[model samples]
Target: MNLFNPSKRVRNLYIKYGENPFVLLSKFIYAAHRQKWSKEEIERVISAAKKGNYIALIRILRSHTHIEE
Candidate 1:
């Protein structure tokens, strides 16, 4: 399956956050269950994670957004 259609939460996170993991993660750890997540946020996260870099996620955490990861 393509990462865009990921099977797990992490992959979904990767798909949704893109290079800016902070947006979705800022609101939810894994947004698959929640209906609050916007498509823009999901797309951003997904795009960010697909880039295969965690620096953005780290940067987001640096802001103290209460990330569970």
Candidate 2:
């Protein structure tokens, strides 16, 4: 995923969900859980997300799930 230039789906998700890191982090965690991600993987993503970078977090989410456009 492009961290600097977000895709259409990512943009839509960002707009729909807003830029709140906490909210996005929850969604990411949910997606990760739905995908049956390993605990370590989930924790790593959570760790990365704690930095509170919107684009980076969205990229991580996009990597794990399909964000329909």
Error of 2 at 44 (Å): 0.4
lDDT of 1 at 41: 52
Least lDDT summed over 10 consecutive residues: which range in candidate 2? 7-16
In candidate 2 the C-alpha lDDT for residue 13 amounts to 32
lDDT digits (tens) for residues 1-69 of candidate 2: 422224212222332335677776776666656666666777765776556567766656565445455
* Model 2 TM-score on a 0 to 1 scale: 0.52
* Whole-model lDDT per candidate: 0.43, 0.55
